[model samples]
Target: MTFSIVARSADGRLHGVAVASKFLAAGALVPAAEAEVGAVATQAHVNLAYRSQGLALLRTGVAPADVVAGLTAADPGRDERQLGVVGSTGDGATWTGSFCHPWAGGQAGDGWAAQGNILVGPQVIDAMRDAWLDGSELPFPQRLLTALRAGDRAGGDRRGRQSAGLLVVRRRGGYAGTGDELVDLRVDDHPDPVTELGRLLDTHTMLFGKPDPATLYDLTGPLADEVAALLAAAGHPVGVAGLDGALASWAGVENLEERIVAGRLDPIVLEHLRRTAPPGRTGD
Candidate 1:
């Protein structure tokens, strides 16, 4: 009752899994990834250990097909399990057990795999494969999301949807550059889970995505004064000399310092100021 894609980004800098299923918290059950390692999605009987073990195997330089072989080698119920993997080297492979629900199958290539069981039809995986091919230049997270959307468009789980998720990992892509959960989002139970997951991904990007340096707005003149007033109204008053300090403190508190910078602001940052400034006051 699920469909998923496991993929490595075109640049080989990230790995991701996108999945949707007629199961609660499908996100928690089906997808896993680690930076510089690979990604996996195990469904159709759902072997949770396959996630960690699969990554470990990928990290060991095992080929994606070999990882799938090793995962099913010792399993008593391998006939009921479905798995997909994309290795660090960008090779990919998939397995759909013989006993999985009807319309079950999989397709894989050098950098991606698409698999599903109990799907509406073969079109589900076909659409996902086409979508992944079409989104080669998009951010990995966006590409994965787009693949999920395409699967849904072509008729996804025949049973219906309860949850959807996207998991992407990159070196030092986490908040504050501390870890690698570049994009991890889920809609555990939504009438339109894919759409909802996309919304969460967008919000995550806004809150944490780096702005282009070319678009940064230096805080000076009227912009600085207006920002200072907003800070004061928000309970962080500082005179002109300390305006820069005040903005710094506020940005730290909101976790937007990456885009806000010190004295320079991103257009997103300025828009934030407009949204947070007092009702009757507008930024100049």
Candidate 2:
């Protein structure tokens, strides 16, 4: 009924999970991670305890394989559960219980695990594993979701798609650097949940992601003039001396405040303002 991948970033500072299932709101139950600790995906009979318990074990420096062993060995329903785990400093591990529906199993390697139950075929897990290996260049959250998408394309839950989720954690990576959650996106229900999940991730990145220093432009000269005009056209006009304040107000309204800088502008934010400015106006 589900497929998932759990992984740690190459530098070992990030950990995450991406999952999709015929079950509703799989995100709420199947995936868990802790920055600098590890990630876990528990499905099939879905032992919810495996999520927190697995992380606790990883926090103690337990190897992922041992975490799986310890968790399942102590459960009477272990034969009906499926699990995958990855620790901060070692290879990942996976387990498919004996009673899980057919076309179920998993694969694991350094820093990653892919697993599923009631899937279309082994190809689902295979595709997920291959994508995880091939996506080393992607951002951690994107890489995990890329693997989930591959499994979906290969034939995900045998029943069909209903929900999807992506979660990534890094130290001080949350909103305003206040928590460990870097990305926690969910498409609780969608006709094409994986695709919808991808779209939400893009929006999340735009609204919450850090601006690239390389792409920031000083708000002086023509660039500043263009922005000022754009703001005015959008009905937040300001005098020449108050450009910064006006830009901040406009960005707040547009929910682009995270990308705002004191005297510099992110190109992405500038483009968004241009695109959203009233049509027939010079800024537009």
Q: In TM-score terms, which candidate is top?
A: 2
Q: Which 10 successive residues of model 1 have the least lDDT summed?
A: 275-284
**Candidate whose lDDT is highest:** 2
Which residue pairs in model 2 clash with each other? none
lDDT, residue 22, candidate 1: 85
Cα lDDT of model 1 by residue, 1-284, tens digit:
89999999877889999999888999989999999889999999999999999999988899999999999997888999999999888569999999999999999998999999999999999999999999988888999999999999898999888899999999999878999998888899998898899899988888889988899888898877887778887666776648778877777787677776767878887787668767754333
Q: Count the clashes in each prediction.
A: 0, 0
RMSD of candidate 1 to the truth, in angstroms, is: 1.7
Superposed by TM-score, candidate 2 places the C-alpha of residue 79 at a distance from the truth, in angstroms, of 0.5
State the local distance difference test value for candidate 2: 0.93
Report how far residue 92 has shifted in candidate 1, in Å.
0.7
Q: What RMSD value applies to candidate 2?
A: 1.4
